[model samples]
Target: MKTLTYVSTKSVNDLTWPTTYDNTNIYSSALSVLTDFQTAGPRVIESNTRADELVQLMKKEHVRMKIVVDTHNHFVGVISLEDLSEDVFIKQVAEGYKRSELMVADLMRPKETLLALSYTSLKNSDIESLLYSQRENTLQHLLVIDEGTKTIRGLISSNDIVRQLRLDVDVAFSSFEHTYHSAILGQKFQSRSLKVA
Candidate 1:
């Protein structure tokens, strides 16, 4: 058997800690969910990423939404698979916008127009409150913003909520406007059934 002794260097400076954490134990709660960027990290794409490339990326990643960031990696907007569809591209071409020239920035919904919920607010809320807010806003995806940092903290999806609650939720909406409408209406029907029983 051989034994070795380890010694620490006398002058170790400028060492840095890892910024990443293991996310295995994260879960959903009445306070807030774990799917937020603070926990799961944001799925981001560059603003200059081509629309065609975006479609391929989404398919490869098995993701429907991606956060759009600038060259400096600052959050700019968000893009969805729905926004990168062949139909959308075809329509844009019909309107004289060159398909080859389109970029993620052009296809993303500007952050200002997106619906966001405060992380602090979510901390004090329950699943029912989340459902109510989703219904009221007709939102399939809700961005959680940290009030102190004023930065995106995470995302909450209607389907995720349904899965967590073990409810059968069909979120197949025809358009952006219909996304949450169906969920809200479904919740209403569930409420009515509970009342009748």
Candidate 2:
């Protein structure tokens, strides 16, 4: 009698990261893809937070954006790292405000100008339409408000959308893709002639 032994040709080291698209979710809804507030609430910093402290927090969190809040814990405005580093520092220095004296309230885009989309609108709309709207508005972030509660339900960002789609969706959104990256990651920071009040 003759016996044969089998040798395995594959090992764990031969494996590679998955490049396959998530074919199961070809059609997705806004609610399905959006970064819900419950999942990742906006990063918050006090209005009086020092510029240096803000930078340290951002580095620690690996985030480029934050929401400014007052001592009462009410939302006051929003600030991005680009605004802090590019616009604030230069403007403050030029105006003779010491760097150590700089605060987030001085650099934020105040809540009075907050722009948003209704939750109903987002629920009924598609990603392409949203991208076009964001591009037209030149916004990196758009709040979604629940009309019934009159409260912010979620936030959408170009970075989040791009990251979600990269997993599986293969449609060509050439112009939108460009707009998304540029709006979010691009350094187009500009200083206002006068400080925001």
Residues 155-193 of candidate 2: C-alpha lDDT, one tens digit per residue: 776555656666322222323355444433242332232
lDDT per residue for candidate 1 within 1-197, as digits (tens), equals 89999978788767787453333111334344337665577899999988888899899997888889999999889988878889999998999999989999988898888868788888877665565555555545667888898788888776555554444445454322343344456657888999999
Per-candidate Cα RMSD to the true structure, in Å, reads: 9.0, 13.1
lDDT score, candidate 2, position 145: 80
lDDT of each: 0.71, 0.68
Q: Return the top candidate by TM-score.
A: 1
Model 1 TM-score, all chains together? 0.73
Worst 10 residues of 2 by lDDT: 184-193
Please give the clash total of every predicted structure, in order: 2, 0
